[model samples]
Target: MIEEGIVAFSGWMTNFELLSSGWRAGLIVFGLVFGTATVAFMVSRVIAAMERKFIETRNIWDDAILHAIRLPLVFFIWLQGVYWAAEVAYYYSEADVFTANDALLEIGFIWVVSWAVLGLIKQIEQVLVSPVKMKKPMDYTTVNAISKLSRMVVIITVILIALQTLGYSISGVLAFGGVGGIAIGFAAKDLLANFFGGFIIHLDRPFKVGDWIRSPDRNIEGTVEQIGWRMCTIRTFDKRPLYVPNATFTTIAVENPSRMSHRRISETIGVRYEDIDRVSGIVSDIRSMLQNHDEIEARQTLIVNFLAFNHSTLDIMVYTFTKTSEWVKYHEVKQDVLLKISDIIIGHGAELAFPTQTLHVADSVKLKHLEHDFGRDQGRGDTANEAGERSLRDNHEEAVSQQKSVEKHYAKPR
Candidate 1:
């Protein structure tokens, strides 16, 4: 259809034979420009319709291809139109300005082709990482790495091709690059290290984008936002962005909490010394509770035993794992487990421990001391005795009040 249109335009141009060559060339240039615009517009509309149609289909390649070629196709049309126009003008006027027309056309074609390929790579990368487009989306880090490497390969190839087209010898260019690479590598050694580090990360698959990672070796604890060639961006818990060099991951030991199967719940509950006899029963009930609980992972190691005789309490060690690795949900499960344990202790008529001390004295010693004090007061007279009695009564009342306050502070809900 395009060839037929061009032939018809040629027939129409021949009708202006009476006009001068310059006038003929100018008219042809105008015609080519108009044709280019019209063709480009039509192509864009067609591609848009095709994109909408292909989007509904399960196959993503058609959509990606259509999207990739839209702009480049239009550019190619304009390039050919302008090249033809210049050729016509040069043929008529024999101007030196249009001498590089062939070279320009070749270079332009290379650029447009490379541009489309790069666009296609980008589209495929996006499609693979999109959950809606793919049933099982590819890893973002892997897709990104592949896309970048593909684009780099396309660009380097285009550059070499363009140089060859411009009459530069391919072997000579390669030889020059080989000699210059050593200097370039040394000058950008850190950059090369970071790039290689990123490449290693992509290969090793230790952690990926969006993983919550922490490093004990450094203060790197955050959700990975992006893994770039030079640096990895992490968003910390406090919502601050941390830019760490990619090389840092090569040396540091990263803990990926996001990849954990379960979150641990390890706690030590202490009961009053008076409840020592009930310790065995309490531990037994706790172990049973953990084994039967819905949130706890029964398959994991679950231990509930009387661990130690603490100064003020009998400590029971509760070591278990929750079924979920989610931070908030794990905490909720832990809270429920702790509350249930508390209830079990209460049901067994046992109380949680608090610091306390008891002192024992012989009754004879107490009586002798009281008697001596009383005798001394009597000798001092009735006024001294009354004062002593009042002080003793105040002290007793104060002690009782303090005891009640302490009991109130430690009181638990039924």
Candidate 2:
């Protein structure tokens, strides 16, 4: 019974000694877990308080940082706390029976994964929100493209980090990537051409939205409405949308009428042959009149010429240009110029000629016709001849009689 009691007591003493020896290590593990949890809770509370303050103040940017950016930041903060706890665990383990280098490697893998994931989240939030704050009107395509580009960069960076962590040398990987990129460049030559074309458009600014453009090669005339990476979108005057490849626009001649300060208008005015002699004087008057015309550059008005002599009349063409492109304003200016021209024509004594021809009858035919008339009634013809001569005398007598009657009617005044 005494030996059995000694054995039990020895066993209890051994167990107690072991428990006491491990108490500090156990306390460190407990503290690490407790500290990590405490820090995580405190971080979340602080973030919540910040969001509430931002909302109350009505600060949009601050609100974005709180609501939009806080989640990733919270994750990183927790990761940091975990990282510190992990370091404490490593220190405690170093003093124990086991080295935690293997555990540290495991933790490191987790850390990298956490960093990549959280970083991705932060980047995506920034990409989406950055354009929201911009004052310029947002283009969805541009925003999406920029977002995709940034994501791709982030993905590539994460891939490289993962590869490095897995013990791959970056120098060798870079060399392989260089060779691969060269092959890709050769394969996507046309895509590269379009990409360069897009860059050229941004730099050159050939045309902007709402501009009327004419492409020489395609015989396309339209208003520019959108410019994209692969194509330019144009809305035709007929209201059809045309998507033209950037390559074509970059290589072709583009006529942008919107770039001009004013448009030139040219036309001709005609007059008759009877007005030809007076044409030189008319031309000088027109030149003087055009000098005062608001729209006309008299230097460019080619001529007021006697263009041709046609079958009936002479053609005088008036060639001139207007200073404005607007169709309505141009017509108004032209109408005023024409009114002055018509007034100038009427001021001259020579009238505008119509198509006319002079008919000549032979004297022999006239004499024959009169002789026949005389023979048809000889006695009557003699009397008609005396009557024809007496008709002039009768007109003179009638005029004298009318004059005497007019004088008698006015005699009362005398």
Candidate 3:
């Protein structure tokens, strides 16, 4: 009876000891989690307050920095607080404590890198909006190229840091990465080429976002929409978007029409050949109209004798330039010039030419008709010569009338 009672007491004591130890361990873990969370919360609030104070100060440089480096940076600070608190409690931590730290460091490094990347992007944005005027406006292609490159650089940096934190030997990893990178670069040669091409475009600045450009290689004309690492997108006047390789842009001759201060206008004007005597008067009138006109800014006039003869028309080219680059205004100027020229041409008492062909039959047919009318003429033999002459004159007049009627029917409209 004594032996059995001692065994029962010992078993009860062992069970109680286990229960107490488990409760204490659970409490310690709970305290560590709670303490880390509390520290993180406090750090976040401090960062937010500092950011708010900085914003309220209204310093331009400080505002840019605070605005650029706020949210992500504050989160990074919170992460650091949690990491530090975890370190402080590591003495009482479980067997997986070091592994947990590694994970936390990985996450923290990524956040830190992300924050830095965002700051860089914000800096670029500020530069674009800077009051310092550029020779050309900032283009979407340039902005995109810069942004994409910055992101790529940040990604590489983050990945390197992550590898380092994950127990990778930095030197060995880099050496292996160099070889692997070479292979990947070869595989993605076109992509890398385009990325570099986009970089060159941003630096060179062939065209801006709203500027119209035409490619010499391909007759494609459009305005730039976006510049990407591999390609650039252009929105055509017809509202179609064109995706072109960045490398091709560098190679092609791009004509930016919007960059010009004015558009060049050249047209040919046709006047009747009979108006040769009044050509000078017409030219002077046209010149005066162009010089005084509100739309056209005439540079100089050239007497371009395009066609010496067009059977009925004379071709003269009216070479000129407009001051405005607007398409609608250009059309208005052209229409005005044409109308004035047409009025002047008609007022000169000269009609434009029409094609006419004179047909002649053999003299035998006339002789045959004359023979048939021999009897009638013989009866009036005394006045035969006079009567024949009058009849022939009337017939010639009628033939001339018929030819004019045919010519007028086939004439082209002015």
**lDDT (tens digit, per residue) of candidate 3 on 119-139:** 868666655655553335465
Candidate lDDT (C-alpha), each: 0.87, 0.64, 0.68
Query: What TM-score does prediction 2 earn?
Result: 0.46
The alpha-carbon RMSD values of the candidates against the true structure, listed in the order shown, are: 4.4, 16.7, 9.1
lDDT comparing candidate 3 with the true structure = 0.68
* Clash count for each candidate, listed in order shown: 0, 0, 0
Q: 315-406 in candidate 1: lDDT tens per residue? A: 89999999999999999999999999999999899998876544454668655655666676677775655756755665567667777777
Residue 407, model 3: lDDT of: 79
The ten-residue window of minimal lDDT in model 3 covers: 1-10
Q: Which stretches of candidate 2 lie over 4 Å from their true place?
A: 1-176, 298-303, 310-313, 317-321, 326-328, 335-414
lDDT by residue for model 2 over 1-414, one digit each (tens)?
423543464467567775442454455456656876787678778889887877666344566556654555556555555545455454444455235544545455555554555555454555454555445544444544455456566667767776676668898899999999899899987787887786577657777666889976777898888777777799998999998877787778999987765545443444566677787776677767777787886666446666677655555566777777665887898888877877776676444444444334476865665566555546565666865445445545766777677656543310
Better TM-score candidate (1, 2)? 1
Best by TM-score: 1
Cα RMSD of predicted structure 1: 4.4
Could you arrange the candidates by TM-score from highest to lowest?
1, 3, 2
Number of clashes in model 3? 0
Could you tell me which 10 consecutive residues in candidate 2 have the lowest summed lDDT? 1-10
Residue 11, model 1: Cα distance from true site in angstroms: 13
